[model samples]
Target: MSEVWAERQRRTNQLVRGIARKVLEGPIDGNRLYGLCRLTWITEAYDAEHPAYIRSTKIPALGDALHQNFTGRTLDEVANEVATQLERPELETLVRSHTGFTNFYKAYRNSAREWMLMHEAEITAIFQRAYLLQSDADAQLLGADIAALPSIPKANHPHLLMRPEYLLTPACFALDPRLRFPILNGAERVQSVLRRIGAADRSVPAQIQLFVGLIGQNGVRDAADLDQLGLTALDGLGRADHEPMRQLLMHVPDEGDSLPLKDEEDVRRLQQALDVAQRRVHNSMTNKLRQLLANWTLLEGRAKDCRYDVLVKGYDGGDNDLLLEVKSSVDSAQIRMAIGQVYDYWHRLMGPSSDCHAAIVLPGRPDTATEELLQWLEVGLLWLEGGQLYTSTEWLEEFVAAVGPKK
Candidate 1:
């Protein structure tokens, strides 16, 4: 099993590196561009309706494309291969018919050549510099060069060279045989990890350099190993050992601290503390909902990384559309935290188009100033008053009125 896995990894890396070299060489054509496009991971993968739904779903097709003799194929032929080869007819139809895909594919095949022809020299030079980035100064110059590249007209969907992660950084990784540059496509995960580990530098280029530095400081073999560790830590997969990987992830020493500590341990300690404190509040909220709003079922809602407390099921027992975050106090800090949590739970966790309701519950009523702030942000506020639940938002008031028994 281990041998097979290693061989698979080796082959994948070889393919990626080969494409990366081709990209750095000038006089790129449609076939080479198509290969790069297949290598590029777009942000639209997050959208289920899009052709590239989950990135992994296209892996087989991508592998076929990489290995096939597809030199003279047109854009339509490439799309057809991507669609029909995947064993999913629906995806084939989507690739062939979806307007977003059509727009992007047309733009890629028709316009990419002209654009690359115009900027190929500058692009190659920038990536060559990125290949040997040594210090912060080098990284900064590379970033500036990329930023200064003449802007192409924005497309309805992303293309091969659309974003830094889509092409440049990956190409840099491919060009460098040592795999120094870790892919920054998952920048949000990197940012979250930095915050969790207590790093102060949040800029993208700085973050990339810091990651490379961490790879060396922690004795990581290469960017490939670091990338595996990242997926293991963030996406919760890959075969990297958990305890040692946790140490790597948590290596940044806290301010005024002597040495690095396991960040997962720190997070566990903090989470345990929060859970202990929220136990009573959760129980009280549970009892109140059970007594006052019996019809609305109470459940827990989970996002990718964390779970939000108290999902109030819709009246018809349909979607859990009402998200309630319980905080221990009505203090300014707690209110601010609740606001961010509820908003993230509603907008990010539950899709922005979910038409969900979210609110913060506190032990006591907030001061007028705090109330005004909540109102200004259009966040609903609920509090405990005289052994009963009370709400400041009229929609909430109407909801309770319509559902719960009189008073």
Candidate 2:
């Protein structure tokens, strides 16, 4: 994960763990359960499964089913309506039979409140035990105990309800921030990431534990950072708007640290190399632009901790600012990285000031796909070809008229 993202996660963790200490770990009550529903990753997974009902109603259904509050009465009415709906002939095929409908009604009729009352003590005990987890054995047992939880409720699929991995994992992490327990959507995506990184084969729980350990070794101190690693690995490469997957892809390990830097010296050396390379890339691009374009003021731009390669100020002696990011190569990976980086630098660093533009400077002309991607992002492109500077069609007219004809 980039330092920017890691820092964001750190701030988020502080808030999350603070809430856990105050709301989740303090006492068992409606507010505590409501906090889990509203403040944790469990909310997303749960809402996806129960989109038919809003939290104001569903949470009370889960926690205070027999109460006389409006929420409870509304939920009770909903359960009755659902039972009546299940009696329809069309739903019989989907729901199995009258007996199945009866069971489904009973699951709700019995109320999530009743179920919670029966198992709340055990669930809380397991959640508290997360603070004491010390080894793989402890994690395995925790995973097992969580799996033993009665069900992961589904408003739409009564028969399909099973273990609440999504809820339990986040609950455990919230209670025991030290464990950095990953918020699991499911096992398939985690398994896919492990395979893509060439991690050894293992059970889903073991694989997650392995990833947790790997990220910790690599200086990832937040659960959100681990999630970012998986997201970048899984979706970033294929999606242009995402952070470049190459950042994570370049460091995958077959048998060691996910991001392997043997020691402090190795990290220092890598940073030094990157700094030198960036300087050369920026300097060369800046020098070439100086020779190619006339009557334009060029300088480096800085915003907070981020730096732009070259900032072209007062274009054509006007107030327009054009920010350029120079890439040393035109490969798809380089272009993709350039796109994400420049877009971030442009929107975030440059802000939404009027008459400001952003573009990528490349060593050679990119292919059709790269051009299309940049065009879709509404980013201008400039490349070197046969000792001449070339701009994308969208920029060519402006360059010819305002910035002087391309050399």
Candidate 3:
């Protein structure tokens, strides 16, 4: 594994161990306590399975143990019932860490309750960590990192059904490996446990909300999920229009210390955003030019299956039309491209029309070399300055000198 994956696993293992310690230290009630153990068992089974179906195969038996025999029962009673039904010596050993089937419930019941009530939040945090680990493991098995997985969509009243088969459908597994089962089994376990405990109401309990928040904090690992988290966070802060926050949220990792935003990925995203903004500005400039000019109609120009930004025609209707190529900025690259595009547009669209003219429009003026290049090409130049559009008199004079005045 790469160092990044290794670090991810190390952090996940640390959280899992911490959760286990917290669970052992608390006096959680039997049902809630066993719920945590069940979660652990589900995770272990999912990870250890070769064919992966063993995870779901065991769920029905486990559910029966929880709902029928162990409901409202003490921890000891639940453990004994599970041991009897499972009857697998190896399974008993696996669960012994949490269940302690060898010990009687009467010995620790009162003490457990006291510890649980005193540190409920801490105990819940343990479960939260477990849920996160499960999510991480699921993501790993799916050939994805937790930082890239999309967030679970919010439901007003999310169904808590423990349908492992549905959760581990072929489509889910197909995203990574065809043979991998339990693709999203961890999330299913969390949701199912919550519903089983009658905690699936719209007003999610504080503990459950904490779990969700933890997932949002550490679960998102993909661009879509990052976008969702950003939008959600922005909505919460009433700053939906804030660009910096959106950028930060989009790149921030779900786990590990965040690095400064100076990486190539950040540059690429910024460039993409800039390209979009520049295109919008270019289009707006085209529209403004259309509105400002008189006795001239500007439409999109297409020739030889190539499209130019604007095509101009006089109301008198001769072949003396003008072709305009708009650029977001007056860089050498944009200047070169604009000149070539205008020439091609005129050659292909206006064909043999000596009266046609071509111009390059930009949001800002270019340097001396760029201006000279346009003059040499005999192309007209129009640029924006101080919120006003201005035509380059020098470019017009060079155009007239080279091509002569319009007939």
Error of 1 at 57 (Å): 11
What would the per-residue lDDT of candidate 2 be over residues 275-360, giving only the tens digit for each residue?
Answer: 44544544555556655553443444322334556656545355566767776667676566667667666766447755347888
Candidate 2 local Cα displacement, residue 60, angstroms: 9.1
Choose 1 or 2, whichever is better by TM-score: 2
Report the alpha-carbon TM-score of model 2 versus the true structure.
0.42
Q: Output the TM-score of candidate 1.
A: 0.36
Please, what are the lDDT tens digits per residue for candidate 3 over residues 181-280?
A: 2222234433443344344442222322322333333233331222122222221222223322111111222223332221223224335324545545
The lDDT per prediction is: 0.49, 0.49, 0.40
User: Which runs of model 2 end up more than 4 angstroms from their true locations?
Assistant: 1-12, 23-34, 41-115, 131-137, 187-191, 194-205, 216-221, 231-245, 249-407
Q: What TM-scores do the predictions have?
A: 0.36, 0.42, 0.29
The TM-score obtained by model 3 is: 0.29
lDDT of 3 at 207: 23
**Candidate 1 — which pairs collide?**
none
**Candidate 1: where are CA atoms >4 Å away?**
1-11, 19-26, 29-34, 40-118, 129-140, 150-154, 157-166, 194-204, 217-219, 228-245, 248-407
Q: Stretches of candidate 3 above 4 Å error?
A: 1-274, 302-304, 315-319, 352-356, 394-407
- Candidate 3 versus truth, CA RMSD in Å, comes to 24.3
lDDT string, candidate 1, 1-407, tens digits? 11122222334344444444534454544444434444433335423355452233234324433455544554467557755554444434433332211112334433544554567667657655664566555665565565566544334444334443333555455445555665554345444555644443454566565666656533345665454344323221222343221112111222332322112232343353244344445455545654454434344432233355565656434443577777656667667767877887677554675455788888788899988888787788888766677777776786655554444
Pairs with steric clashes in candidate 2:
none
Q: What is the C-alpha RMSD of each candidate to the true structure, in Å?
A: 15.6, 17.7, 24.3
Question: Which candidate would rank higher by TM-score, 2 or 3?
Answer: 2
